[model samples]
Target: ALLKEMHAAGFEPNAATYNALLGDALQVGDFDQAWHIVDVMETTGPGIDFYTISILFKGYKGKRHSMDAASFDRTLGLIQTYSVKVDEVLVNVALEACVSLRDPHRLSATLATFKQCGWTLPKQCAMHTYATLIKAYGQTRQLDHAWKLWSEVTERKGLTPSEQLYGQMIDVLVTNNRLDDALQLFEEMKDVHGEHLDSQGFAVAYAMIIKGYAQQKECTKALQCYDQMKEHGTRLGLVVFNSLIDACSRVGDMDAAARLFR
Candidate 1:
């Protein structure tokens, strides 16, 4: 009715006006109405832009709290159907929703759609997006895929992998009982991105390594990692120190444990 009145008044609704109407429709869970507004926008010129895409994505995200998995997917379907272009931001939004839902099938489908749309993964894809996908793959025990994405993000894309990503990769390797690979990646992170790392980041990496070695009952290597952490001037947290002491105790090196405790 409002749109009808606006059209009758010779007031041609632009994208903003249409977006406003879309928001109102989505607010009430009227996805059909929302898509209709999007259709109007596309047909009337001033077609959907990034901002419009963002608004639609955000609306789906907001609705997820109350919507079931099927409903969430339907709302997202509208974006895929109506999106003018699938840029990195839009892809991130879709991936994010999939992650939150833990929908691996949806993730695979979204990537397939991304390719079908002739959208290559943007070189400037944000690190968080890479991290999220890596994590999603890791959780599914697809370690190879995780590492491939990591390499592309850091090497081909030339984006510096964050300490969080490094830590996540180390944890994934360690969890999968690939201790040697974990150690290698641990050292590689420090070597390749050492200058980019802060003390806390180094601490996180060292703690993961120390915990990994300790879990494997390799007290000597765990101690080596602890010493390395100190040498790097990383502020060791109490949890890491406890892990080191536990490693010593596990190896019946009470003297070393006592020294650490003191």
Candidate 2:
């Protein structure tokens, strides 16, 4: 409100006003206004150019949200146009913007942006970037490469693998006809990350393992896994039972399958 009065009175807003506008847009994540303010500050003066660019990045973050996403390419174009001398925060935001794009080709190009900016991808940023890449790769039928990357990341130093991380690995294994590998990693997940696996996770993971074995024509293993899940109170839902029945029929265990249904 003070800023509007100052602008109206032919008194150009001060750095504080400019700073406030940029900050408010960020704190509240008003991306549309954030970008507008960025243009205004850059037009106003370079005294606050860096600060404005930083806010523009925040604006981009606001757009990362659904129902608020703007044109990422447009934001990227403007940022690159204005970032003749961008700093670390600007670079980080730009890389994050790439993650939000969820475009495999564009995201791949972000590696170059990191190189050009001389900025290290922070762990949070790296994890998300890798996750987006994994999803893209899976959709593009590049599952093997995604698995390879997942393995490398799992072995990285000073980084504990997360549920999402292990889940990605399990996804790759199951997709690639590697049921045994998925089961082994599921156990490894329990051993290495005790108390982290919740009931939902246990249920989901066991279901996938059963599905994988069924695909492999391994009925006995699937039934065993189902029993184990039930023992843990992760109720064996109807879908899992249906899958078990299918597996039993596939491997010539109709009697076992009948007993299961009863």
Candidate 3:
């Protein structure tokens, strides 16, 4: 219909027009027709560009999330067969999907696919990519490899580990009962960037440390960390508040607990 309208109006349909049509097809659940449009673009002039490929990959990825495993793999196969240049955004999307799946075997397999295609984490890859992969490794209890990757990216690659990255590592460490290392990293975060740092990230790090200390029955240390938050005037979230309250209750500091509750 659109093509007929274009022809009637003598408006030459270009790549953008084809891409728009293809996107509409995907939007309406016509994957086969979308692929046909992709093929048309390949055979015609002005082949599929970066945006076109990104849209296709993004659409397939979104579709794959709700699909069964076989359908998901089929979508992945279609994406892999594309001959377009894969950018960091595309690779990041793939990594995020693998992480969301939470299957270490699938994660490793996707990584193997990356290896086969000569794709590595590019130096300019966004922090989220590194964070996602770190999280996947953490979920798999591959802490050593996770830390090695973190260190390589931060120290060697010269990427500044964002507070979220630090939070992720700390959370993973605390999960694995590596409280000592988690505390050390938490202190590093605090000492490196002293008081008055207003960020949700800092709040998260604080909560993790407080929770870990509380779990260890170090109520004094937990309260001390809580006090530090007050000193810095960093805004606290409900999660932190809950951790502190739990800490006080665990230590039978009913008075302190009530004070925090109020």
Candidate 4:
């Protein structure tokens, strides 16, 4: 209605005005309306810019399940179609979408497309970006790729790994049945960032390691990890507690299992 009023008043809405409307649509999860705005912009109003592409990508971040390959490809096609100069923010949003989608093929294709568009992945990105890429690789069972990325970040001069990054790497390692590696990394993390272990973020990593050990029937090791977690004052959630109980039952330690159950 407001747009109609503007049109009747002989006021032209530029790309920024349309971009704001598109953002509002996306914010309300009105993807249909957002696309309509994009279509109108493409046909009559100001052409799409990098911000437009970024907004679209950000909008899809939460609605990744609705984003199929065709939709993703069309979004990518816009960059070439409009000669949109990809910026770091846009690249990060793309990476996030790839992570949320958990499609390795799409992730690989996106990176390849970015390369073709002359934006190479930097040796170092924001730690959250690295964590998201690591998770995408991990979810796709690309353990080596995930590990290689972890090593790259650690080896970067003077760049301390964020706690979130460590948690992600630990998760990848634990999920891959590399409990020993995960434990070593956990210990290293404790030594470096021990004071911060009490945070709930690290608690999830601890739970992963405990669950890994439990799955392997290494109940004793699982219990040891639980003890360490307690020692570090990490919050024990139901997942960890349940893993400990199961680990005890697996080892025929009914007494311990009963104690954990309580």
Runs in model 3 lying further than 4 Å from the true structure: 1-15, 18-53, 56-75, 123-128, 158-160, 214-220, 242-259
lDDT of 2 by residue, 1-262 (tens): 6557977998887666786777786677576676666567667633444555556556546645532235555555554565545555666565566555556576555555545645543555456456545644554457776775676576654466666666666666776777778888899877876574446656667777888888888899999988877667775777678789889989899998998857
TM-score of each: 0.59, 0.55, 0.68, 0.83
The numbered model that scores best in TM-score is 4
lDDT of 3 at 257: 79
**In terms of TM-score, how similar is model 2 to the real structure?**
0.55
What TM-score should be assigned to candidate 3?
0.68
RMSD of every candidate to native, in Å, equals: 6.5, 6.5, 5.1, 3.1
| CA lDDT of each prediction against the hidden true structure | 0.75, 0.65, 0.74, 0.82
Instruction: Give per-residue lDDT, candidate 4, residue 87.
Output: 64
List runs of model 2 lying over 4 Å from the truth.
7-19, 23-31, 47-64, 67-70, 84-97, 121-159, 168-184, 199-262
TM-score of 4: 0.83
Q: Hey, what RMSD does candidate 4 come out at?
A: 3.1
Alpha carbon lDDT of residue 20, candidate 3? 89
Residue 42 Cα positional deviation in candidate 4, in Å, after optimal superposition: 1.9
